[model samples]
Target chain A: MKRFWCLFFMIWPVLALYVCWIAPSMGWWFPFTGPTGMKAASPLGERIDDLFYMILYITTATFVGTQIALGYVLFKGAAATDEGNTEKAWYSHGSHNLEVIWTIVPACVLLFIALYQMDVWAQYRVKDSFPSETKQGAIAEVTARQFEWRIRYPGLGPDGKPLPLMPEPQPTDLYTVNDLHAVVGKAVMIILETQDVQHSFFLPELRVKQDAVPGLDIPVWFKASKSGDYTLLCAELCGWGHYKMKARMVAETEDKYLEFLQNLTKSQNYDGVPETPAEGAPVASAAE
Target chain B: MRSKLVALVLCSGMLFVCGCGRTEPQFSYREGLSPRVQEYVRTTVDEKFGTPHKIRVWDKLPIQAHTALATVGEGSKDNSLVVDISGASRPIEPGTEVVWVGGTIMPRGSAPVTVEAFTKDKNLLSLVAAPPAAPKAGDKIVIGPGQTLTHGRLLYAEHCQHCHGVAGDGQGPTAPYLNVRPRDYRKGLFKFTSTKEGMKAHRSDLARVIEDGIPGTYMPSFKLLKPEESHAIIEYVLFLAMRGESEFQMNNLLASDYSDASVANRIKDGETQEKVIEEFVTRVKEGEIDEEVNQRNEKMIADWVSAQAEDAVIVPKEKRNASDEESIKRGRELYLSGNLNCVACHGESGLGDGVQTYSVTKNTDTGKDNVEPGLYDTWGNKLKPRNLRLGMYRGGRRPIDIYARIEAGIKGTPMPAFGAKLTEQQKWDIVNYVLELPHELRTPGTGVAPASPATKPAPVATTAH
Candidate 1:
């Protein structure tokens, strides 16, 4: 019974560690790889995780070394034969050498980690480093309000070129108001705004999350590596209906995207209606 | 003594360290905390300390292997009943039997018996004799007459006072944000309706609006209420609206005595403040001075409310005249074709599923796209397009009612005021055409000869103010 108890105690910690590492990957804890699931969204996230493991390994080694020293000292003292010749254990008032070594070592380690993270963070946030082709190819604006995200794509202008970003005070040039569609293989700059309260635009797969602040324009940029449908979600708590704010982004080949944009534009204007109608009545009559 | 003292010192030191280092469970749901407080806690903690290892309800203590006593009544007369529940989880479900530690009695003669269950904290979960019986079909919940007033008071405190003001004066906390300020329930003029001139919304119409909600604006749908509950709320809303209107009219009457504009002007010029006050007080006391005026205004408001209610009804006499399946088929073709161009905005499915929806401007009020405010007819007015899928015709859903709207055009809106444009038979054809868009658009039908062309020009309403 004593041997069985000792074995059980030894095996418990190993079993716990096994569960923690393997359960998440095997779908026991997090069953899916989408939003709300535990999987990392971008390659950058994986890289950061790798850095975290490295630091953890170093700290764990230090902890184990100190614990072993403590155990050895306790064992030696327990075995000492004192029998009233009790000279108190030797005591040191201070240890300047030990203090300096501990302090400087930790400071250097922290500085190294901080310096290592700067480049990764900058690469993830800064737009210019992205390939020009990828940047230009997938451009769309996502506006968040209350509990919903509104996506806008710039359509080609009358000159058969992409419309220049309109200056303020000209409400007409805004992509959504003008029914603009983004051409494939072009950069999409999303200008996010909130109508009522605060909301966050989060695209997990793209590793992009930005708060939609009212009365302020927050810009977020992303390039889809492959063309498929992706979900857009509101990560901020706007109101009771926040869960319902959902939209979809469709990425397609450059040719297919252009075809969709042109067809959509043509459908907006019908051929049967006269360009200029006779007096009061203009174009087609049905309004209701 | 020395060894014992050393052992005691070591144990004390160990206790101190354990107590200082132990983690405390976080408690949520403190009273008076704003709803956003929890969100702020979650975000800030995640940003700083990283995610929690696990979350558990901090208030509940885990149950050990034992049974708790269940009591049923107050002191002395309290009866005990045995409920053999053990090692139960926190957040115990109702009807769970806990062990009764005391005596049980069968009641006799005029006295009542009570039963109760307790949590580990000694808080009462329930105090009843037995499980409630299931409700019978067609039987209403009878909570007694006083429940109406209790419910009304609670509803008013929760929803109405925030916008209608504590006194129903339209001076709500959110009043400042609204562009077209909230309706002073007292004046009682509602804008959207099929009502002729003046009218309070039909109780059902008010409930419908509240349930489905206005498409644009801050008014959100309260679709959570059941049918009967919504009716009760509507009643409460009407009560407040009427009470406020009466008060406003009384104030208006006291402020005005208009014998004649010239006479009033002369009196105003010559009279002192005291004299003016005296005259107003005297006129109000006599009750004869503005009786005619007050009566006229009151009647007008009542008539308007009545007219709106009448307009809200769905008349069935206007269903399609012919039973021929062939006519409906022909009508469906015209609906989708370029001649009518209904599909341009309404979409091919007539479910308001057009591609134009993606491009339509967002409504500033409700934050929905495709709700353009300037889509009114020749008259500069605000109009909303119909959402065909809902099938709740704004002007009454009857076949003829829809026919009339299509024929005359909705006066002020983008629903061009279509009577003269399409032929008489074509108008009927379009009606059948719309019905076909949703269910079966591809069906074939026999063609009907076109009716005689409309002779009179389409009548347009006067320009909006």
Candidate 2:
């Protein structure tokens, strides 16, 4: 019965360790691998990931050390309780030195983590710390409503380059829903606002999140390291249809992005007229 | 101890096995008709379009593509049916039920008869019971619940039924809380459509709404759905809308004479109760009500089909006028001009708080004055004129979109069409001015023109911070 208790106590730690060891390979680790494993998609995201790993290592070491000490003590105590043994079991109220060491150690570790993550935190939240390119202007305005993301981009100018996005919607502004496009490898910013309740803009791949408080214009920025489609989701429970707020961010090359804006302008101004009328044909007759 | 462990393991194993199999939730048709409909009207509609479990799709309706349609071939006999299975989207085997959907020969909408035996080689079917009348050549038949509609029903249940209601009545569980109510498709009136006035919305218009969603409203985009999946859902929505419309027309047919209020009025006017009852029975017996209903149903089907035609769409005769200072100036004049009288509803400053909203108006239903002064749509829901300064256009924000709204007017609303009164150029001018309403700075209270950049007026309520 004593052996059974000792083995039962020891089995839990072994199972926990085994599960942790296989978690990454099973695509169950943090950073939400998505299709790619444990790799952040942005430069700042990489730094954030590094900080996450640092804390994870510290916690893992603490967990294993405590579990091993528990198992060893359990086994030793079980052996001492054998029927043939007559040794006196030593018991103490507490160890002052052990308590002092544990308290100071965790306090120092918490202090270190706080100090280490300050730079990333400032870069993410502090407006002055944003990249110089993003400081110029926001690329688009994202308005989160009941259950959708409405994106508005600046219309292209005569030079075929995008005009500066105005704080107010311009007549030339182009609109799209649930689709946010940005140029890859460049830090771009978006002005986030909510028409109704509170919503959180979460980009899991880029490790970026910001709360879109009503009556406030929040700025959120990220640079995609590689060009691809990533998810944009609302992490906050805004309403009954909160789960329906799913959008995608498409990061592409500069030329492709410009072409997209040009196409949007053309479509937004569509006058029910065909693009090119048949040769020597009347344009008005084509609609029928 | 070993026996206890074995028992524990066996019990857990049974639990795991039980959890393995999952049953797909079945969707059902809406059960009862609206309370406004008479009892006889409900019975007639139900007989023509079966119950929840056994839905009968009328062949003449535009919803035929959603069902598995088969044609009665030349070799069909009194006892056996020879069908062309080309329209059958899903597999059909013995014991499957088939419904005869076409032709006027079979009365009271034929019931679904099961196939006892079938031979694939000869495309022959032997029914367990004979149909009321032999299905002649070119008659339409449906085998089982149509696969497309089945797929559509499942998707609609998951994505749309929460707010659209199972009957597409706009009274879903989450509807009451919304300020701008979800559309009641029973009237077949969509506010934002590319088609001309008095026409049903084109399939593309509805698709765009699903893909882009309506801004300033609770309807969100479901752009992630595959094209085919979206199409199937649209078909299902159309089915519900058409079914609701059919019931609504039938209720109207009897409501004028046989309604509770109408019958009471007749009794007050010195007619015996027995006389009114006798009149209704005679009408039903002579099939006069049925003929009227059939005529209305045929008209509804024709209108829906005609809306799909190319000419039904409103096409601009000329390209849009350039949005310049001169065009904006001309548009502002037209806005305040008595000819357009846009200021009656849309305030002089375009705040949507015009005098019309505060004045008492006649109720169209009872021909009496309304207690509260407000604008009400055909659906009996109170609506406010759009605040143009907010820069939120529900139908759409495109220049051509505004043009269409001006030309055709918003269907099922107080907004009247100016297409006949105004020329194409004049309409374009208003489009330009309305588009610029958000950006144009105006003096508050005075309703004056754009204030000079030097003189600062009271702050306007801008959408932006």
Candidate 3:
């Protein structure tokens, strides 16, 4: 029974280590697609994942060290009392030197981590540190309400180029719900706003998360390395229907992105009546 | 210690039993119906459309019943059975699965019987295997290669029941807290539709609403749902709407003579209680009420069928005019024009604060002046005109959507159709103006003079919260 008590404390950390070793292969690491588990689909997201793995390594080392120390003490204590030896137990009230060493070592580790992650932190949250392309203007305005993401994109100009997205909704703005499209391999920005409550816009694949505070316009930027659909969900529990904000962020080439905008414009102006011969003249006149 | 372990296991087993004892979900009837009326509605609806677990598709209600219903006929052997497939929506094919919905052939377990061979002309179905007991004549069976309604009911319960209610009465758990209530399909009326005025909404209109969702409202988009799943949900919604409409029509019939107020009035007019009660019993026995209900149901079905006709959809004669400054100027003139009277409900500057909103109006039903000074829809909810400056079009934001609104008019609201009075070009002009209202600079009344200084200033348009 005494040996059993010693074994119980030692078994958990070993079991935990086994689970961690097998987790990535089992596709149980990060909430993403890929066999190796640490799959970040954006350039910035890759850097973020590096920082995440760094912290995870530090924590795992600390956890293993503490657990071993605990198991060693339990094992020694249990083993000493296993036999019927008449011996007085040795106990101490305090160990000042050991306490000082333990405290100072953790403080140094904390300071090192604080200094190491400064660049990634600045790139993620600081507006001035954003890429040059994103600094020009946002491509779309994403307004998060209780249960949905309403996206507004600037309509095409006469030259067949997208107009700069306006802060306020323009008459020529194209509207869609729960679908966001952006050019791949380049930073695209979106002005995020909340109509009612606080909602956190989270793109799991791109590793981007921002809180859409009411009455505040927050700019969020990300560059997707792959051209595909990524999951966009709300991280904050804004309301009962928070799960209903299941959206998709599509990353494509510049030409394809522009083509999508053109299609949106055509659909936005569709008037049930098929395009008549007279329609071409007005479009030409407007272009001129 | 061993005894403690046994007790612990027993306690956990009890908890597992409790967890497994979940009650089945049920659809609640609309409130305010008398007990008798409620019972009649329940029995009639249930007989046609069975419970959620054993859903029966009533083919006459303009709903797409995916499964075929057939009654077992004579000369049924152990391996095969003859069935009358006249009531089915389509011919049941070979290899289709079958389940007994009525009579003595009870559903046994998870696995259902499948068809080995189907003779179309003879209406015969040979089973792949024999059941524990042979099926009897007159046993009702449902043939299903498609389980649309069942799939829809389960999905609706999981996703839509929180707001749309099990009965589609718009009184679900979260409904009361919402400012814009979920649609009550009981009246068989939808506000946003592309169909012409006085017609039921087209299936595509409902499908669009489900896919894109109604912006500026709590109904979120279900764009992630697969195409087949969406079709099933739409069919289930149609079933609920038809069922609710039947109950509503029956309520209307009872309202004239059997309402609480009507009963009290009869007693006040010196009629004995027994005599008044006898009148109701005699009417029920004579089947007069049943005849009335059947007629109304037929009319309702006809209305639903006609709405799906190709010509029922509204298509503009001409394409949209250009969005140039000249077109905008002409649209502004039409906005202030007395013939269109756009300023009546929509204010002079398109603020949705027109005088009609604050004026007392007579109630169409009671014929008395309403206590509240506001416009109301047929559903008795206070109606507010769309504030053009918001740029949030609930139906849709497309130019064609706005044109349809201007031409056919939004049903069940104070907005009226101008297609009969205005030409297609004029309607397009209004559509362009309305589309540009958000971007247009706000000036006090533009050209129109402000009301006399004595009158209260018009309400300012506040930003949506």
Best by TM-score: 3
Where in model 3 is the C-alpha error above 4 Å? A1-5, A25-27, A33-38, A276-288, B1-28, B67-146, B267-278, B445-465
Off by over 4 Å in 2: A1-38, A72-89, A277-288, B1-55, B64-145, B257-286, B364-366, B444-465
For every prediction, compared with the true complex, DockQ reads 0.03, 0.25, 0.37
lDDT of 2 by residue, A111-189 (tens): 9999989999999877778899886677889999889999989767656777677766666678899999999999998
Error of 3 at A273 (Å): 0.7
**Model 3 per-residue lDDT at B235:** 81
Candidate 3 on B1-465: residue-level lDDT in tens?
999999999999999998987786556465554456567667777887676777776767777656567888999887698988755444455667888877765645746788898888887889998755779999888787347687788889988988988888888899988878888888888888999988888988888898889887899988878776787798888888887887788888887776667777888999866776678768878999888988998898999899989999988887777776677778889988999888888888788988889998767667777779987776677777888878888889777788778887888778888889888878877887787777766765463221121112112112233
Per-residue lDDT of A74 in model 3: 89
TM-score of chain B of each: 0.40, 0.72, 0.77
Residue B64 CA displacement from its true place in model 2, Å: 6.2
In Å, residue A166's CA in model 2 sits off its true spot by 2.4
For B103-157, candidate 1 gives per-residue lDDT tens digits of: 4322334232233554445433343453232112222211121222234435655
For residues B284-360, what per-residue lDDT tens digits would candidate 2 score against the true structure?
78998889998988888888888889998888887777766677778889998999888888888898877778888
Chain B of candidate 2 vs. true chain B, TM: 0.72
lDDT of 3 at A29: 79
Full candidate order by DockQ, most accurate first: 3, 2, 1
